[model samples]
Target: MRRKVYTKDQILKAAYEVVENEGFSGFTARNIAKKMGISTQPIYLEFKNMSDLKNALLDEICNHLYYDIFPEVRTGDTIIDLGLSYVYFAKEQSNLYNALYVQEYGGGKKMHDFSYNYFHQLIVKHPKYSKLSENKINALHVGTWIVVTGIATLMSSGIIEPTQDEIVHLIDRTINTVLQEDDTSVLDSL
Candidate 1:
């Protein structure tokens, strides 16, 4: 009998599918092998261990978010567009969202940091935020992050099913409230 051979990319693709369909809990070498219709030996041969495979998977997820998910949303407002993209991701890719945010999988920190920094830069460069000081912008970004993440979490968890208008309205209201707050002291504290 001939031994079946799988490349590293092939194994990672199988792992990605497993994670996408089954979330992180179903992310195992055995599952990947099963998905690929091969023995675990091919997976082991392609990677050092599960941890290495996980890191690679994380990179794939991040790339998918950056290239595939985030770029698809364009609302003419960078911050709102970002929020919408995140919400779309949560709604469309519930399993991946839960694995990254809800379950706090191995890639959670990397994803969080990437999202935070990306949104922060958008806020800083936005003309609507130009009148705001650095501290104020930072505060606004934090507030936006909380609101967006909260909405995404709720939707992903099946706690609420808000329409696109409702989601946009909620995000707009939160941003407006942050921008309109008269208490500069609170903004400066951050």
Candidate 2:
């Protein structure tokens, strides 16, 4: 019998499946090998080490979020749509969401940077937010991100099952509160 060789991409896909199904805790070379029905030698041969494989997996997860998850939301408003996509991802891919957000797994900064930059771009382009200073826009993004993340965490853990309408209401209220606070801060400063 001849030995089967796995490409890096194949190994990465197996690793992703392991994490998606079993969360980060199951992200081991042995587990990946088991999933692929091969020995761990293939994984070690394709990647330098588990850390390297995990970093690659993080990129894979980010790509999945960017392509598979984020693009599915289209509510005519980019910012709100992003929030909805996040919540939807949490609900649909709870294990992946927890691995990235709750467990960190070296993905927290990547997710934060991606979300903040994306939100900033949308806010800068929005008619309502375009006039706001960059500082104010950043504040608004952070504030809204906190609320959205909290809701997503709760939803992913099955602690709270809010309807889409409820999520929209909560997100809208958070955005409004942030803007209102910024306005009041300006008034107080005046």
What overall lDDT goes with each candidate model?
Answer: 0.80, 0.80
User: After superposing candidate 2, which stretches have Cα over 4 Å from the reference?
Assistant: 104-106, 183-190
lDDT of 2 by residue, 1-190 (tens): 9978799999999988988888788989999999999999989998999999988888777777777777565666667788999988888888888877778453678777877777887778779778887666776777667778899989988899898888888888877776777444532331
Question: Model 1 reaches what TM-score against the true structure?
Answer: 0.83
The TM-scores, one per candidate, come to 0.83, 0.85
After the best TM-score superposition of candidate 2, give how far the Cα of residue 58 lies from its true spot, in angstroms.
Answer: 1.3
Residue-pair clashes, model 2: 0
lDDT of 2: 0.80
